[model samples]
Target: MRKTLEEKLVPPVPPAVRRAMLDAREALPPGGADVTARLFAAMKENRDAPTLPSSKSFRDAAASESTFRTLLRCLARYAPHICTSNAVTVSEEWYARRPKHVTMGKSTPVQPTIWPAAWRALAPALDAAPIKQSSKRRYRASIDRCAAMVRAGRASSDFGFVAAADLADAFLFNADATARVKPITAAGYLDGLIALGRFGGIDRVHLLPMQLVAEDLREQAAMMPKNKEARIGAFMERGGFGYAADRIAVCLRRAESLPVHSAAGRRALQTAMVCAVFMNKPARKGDMVSWRIGHDIVRQPNGEWSLAWQQGKTGKNTEAGVLWPEVCYILDLWILGGRPDRLVYHRYHELEGLFLLSQSECQAYRNLPSELTLSAIGVPSHDLRTAAADYMRHYDPEHAANVISAHLGHGSQKSGEAYRSECSAAAGQSEWQRSRMIWS
Candidate 1:
């Protein structure tokens, strides 16, 4: 009798190992099951023995390096006993031995363009300007981009003199052409020009034109509707803040019940804490990721949790007082129970204070909110601010603007209004009327 297709694909492993792999296939997500099967087949091809091959051998047999990584994660989750080699070590080795193809079929390397003389001259001034390190980097990048645009348009080698006209031309080129830039990006380049003008390097008279253009660009960008109303409606339809809070509580409970060493438990704890923090206080993603224990997050004398940080965008001192008890509880669980287990021993000294340890971990936390909710209320982490703003506006019309200004770390009350949904106005009016009747 001829062998079936499934039998032909099955690797010659022990019955027990084969059973574990079969269970893994059943347990894993659709994509993950495929990856697991590929991993098993690769292992069989690399060695004659029924025993698992070295990580390097498996990597060699993998279709791509990413596939090898997925296999490692699958092994860690479903068949940990069989995975003896350290995943991190194998990853480092794979990275080190990755094919170093200098040219992709006779392609020459593109060298970085040297900074134009005008930008180079202003570099020292930009560095010395009492601005944040991040801002300085952004301004420098904008200058480089603007210079490239100018060089591409003009034939002059002495593209050393940057002026208001040049910047306006660049903006127009980016706004109306094939290589168009976003309005926000154009605003950034204009900011770079304004900075240069303020440094006394360029003519101060040029400042007005750049500022006006930047303002118009910003207004236009803001006026372009993003279908936020539909998203907000969908979010509220799914029980809004109440539903999210309930889900977070469930995640916290699950985390607490699972063993301390469980990676799934750690992730659940992380997701709960992140959602709680964002729910109580909607902060910028950068601020959320960069939160250090003692500095940004602190325990007050009254035993209430407090957050204090300078807003990265507006550079304003922002503070949130006495967070929700649920938020505080989850923070405690993460700090006392979860974070320590997740930290690598050697790197503990360096990363112990950071709330979200690394960029990858931060990304995972950001992604968890949507995944946990089954994509019913999908929104980026930043959109949490809008949600909070809309919720506040609905409940309290008079105080919402002021509260939103402080809650979201906005520079002014006017800035807070940008986050308010159109529907919130009607909701706020009805709530205000109900409040009047109750008080009357």
Candidate 2:
């Protein structure tokens, strides 16, 4: 007469635990209580007794699930035995005093880290800067790496005065037992250290020279020549790009032909629309994934669609682009019939993201690279972005750098150079074609 899994899982919350949960609800911001209650109810379904998350566990989870962090913090203070993280102790002080220095977010209350006195000196400025929590973690990690270098006798003790040559030696040669650090990582470490110094009232004249070295290293890694010519040649030899647009059109047609009830078929249409938009807009993946239906995109009364773009990486918040009518039609089909998820954060917030993938569906695409593979027609996503930029400059000789910059939503003309460089090989082909026509 053993109980079934569902029966075994339906244990009631203990009296003490319920009291703690009530306290957590009270601590939460308006509307956060609902999120906490839902989270608690979900946790109660587990067979095991409630326990605190580990320090590392809480740190990692806090980044994605801020509500979980909030509840955990409150529970930690109320019932210490259930929680083990040092954060629990910190939370007690935080909730009681409500320090003026502490910053608050929608879900989780920020707690001050116990850094070394020397490092703590830098916290005020760092905290004041308008950066995300994930970024703060990265900056702290970089600082720790640099400090490790110093402790290992590889660099100057003074983080401010650490020389470029020392950084190169430590980063490039693996002065420690670990493998040589990648150039990109080395560059990030350098940038983080410089930023820390800058915000701490360090002089620019001192930081700039070291920063320049890091910049050069980063550019060297990024601008390293890739044999795209060889890859393209091999691809063409295999009959690729023989009317690529026609292939795209056929893919779109196949998507349209799919049965209305098919989720997989609708996903295919979503992919097609993503490709179409990128082909014309030169949008980065971040931009495409985070787009909303109403806020980012709008349909005008005159039957035209406009996209309001904000390139997060470049800090360019204002840019306008056109959305072709055909693209808009596909978008409408996906929005109306695709069964979008109702994300409940701000109740008034509309348009539950432009491209809504289910949790399971997202997991399926987790391993897939950012490349289009519609019925065996595979193409790297960046290729379309590069092609658009190339067509702008190489095919249209009158196109200027500024024009290309505007099209790509780039903050500077310098950013458009990579696309132009890719088109250099095509220049000869274009000239040869012109000469053949003249000879005829």
Candidate 3:
């Protein structure tokens, strides 16, 4: 008789060993549960295995190279006694032997550009242009898309040459069908084409039409409502800044009581710290990730915490005054308690001074706040900065301009105009409501 799938999955280990594996599984983050279970099952099946299964055996069972590495880390943390001294070394060697630059899963074949001759003709001019390398890369990508469109018979072709019409047609392809061209994307595409024309030494008289189209696109983009405005308004309407603050406070409280070694607890503490810093300082994402303990974030003699960093965008030295006490408390808990416990086993020394240790952790720090709030607030992390500015404008209208400029590291007071306008609109709406109530 054939065994059931559930029966096959169950590890045929002794009761004591099974219980130990279950306990170790609980310490793992939610995503690690399945992989950890599989590891234990493999261990139970191999009677010759004293500790972990061989690297080759485990690699066969793993979904991907990334997953195999993740499982190894989990074992090192939760069941370190079972992991051999050379476990990580063996896994690293196995990873190194795998094919380079080759994606694991089924991948779409690369499509050759239709106008190779045109691209070859344009490549030299683009490379030699005295523009930023980033700009050159953007132009090359835009030209590639134009060539693809022409190949697909979706855009005009001028005797196998890519022209302005083809560039415009490529912009409208919507090839992915996921979203239409956003105003900002349209602007980027137009800019790339303009730069390409100049680099190709096309006559200004012939380029006048493309330049005019670029200006029109910029006008349309300016007229469109700002995403920050919409996000701020939605977040404010749904209990505003107070709601996000309350959520962070709840996470911190829960995290404080849980064991530092618990992955879920460490995650909760990290999320609270991320949201709190953004709420108080409103720094850009790059600065937040790059922040170091003794350098960018510091504690003063008065026992208050302050943050100062050279702004990545503007290259200006910006600093924020003492953070809120709640923010400071969460930071202390994470730095002193949760962080060290989490990183002790792996890559701790390499990532000692950084605020966020890994890309996955950084993404979670940026994303989890919004998830916890049910997407009603703090989406994209930057929205927290906008909310902070909006709250000041609404409550402390007199100091809103200067305060926002300083608090958000904005280069000029004019940047606070949108927040001020939002406050005025809300105030006018309130007055209209009160007038109706009196008349009624």
Clashes of 3: 0
- Which tens-of-lDDT digit does each residue in 1-440 have in candidate 1? 86432453355434554566565544654344455555566666766333334555565545566776666655556655443222333565568776555576664667675666766777788889888887887787777666776677732222223444465456656555776766766777767756755673666455666677778777766877666667767777878788778778788788766644355666677777777788888787766766666567775444467788887778888888778876776776665443332332322333346564231223233334444333323555566778887777766766677777778888865675554444466567787888999999
Q: Worst 10-residue stretch by lDDT in candidate 2?
A: 339-348
Spell out the clash pairs found in candidate 3.
none
lDDT (C-alpha, whole model) for all candidates: 0.62, 0.55, 0.61
RMSD of every prediction: 9.2, 15.1, 9.3
User: Which model, 2 or 3, shows the larger lDDT?
Assistant: 3
Candidate 2 or 1, higher lDDT: 1
Cα lDDT of model 3 by residue, 264-285, tens digit: 5666776777777777777777
The number of clashing residue pairs in each candidate reads: 0, 0, 0
The TM-score that candidate 2 achieves is: 0.51
lDDT computed for candidate 1: 0.62
Q: Which candidate is the best by lDDT?
A: 1
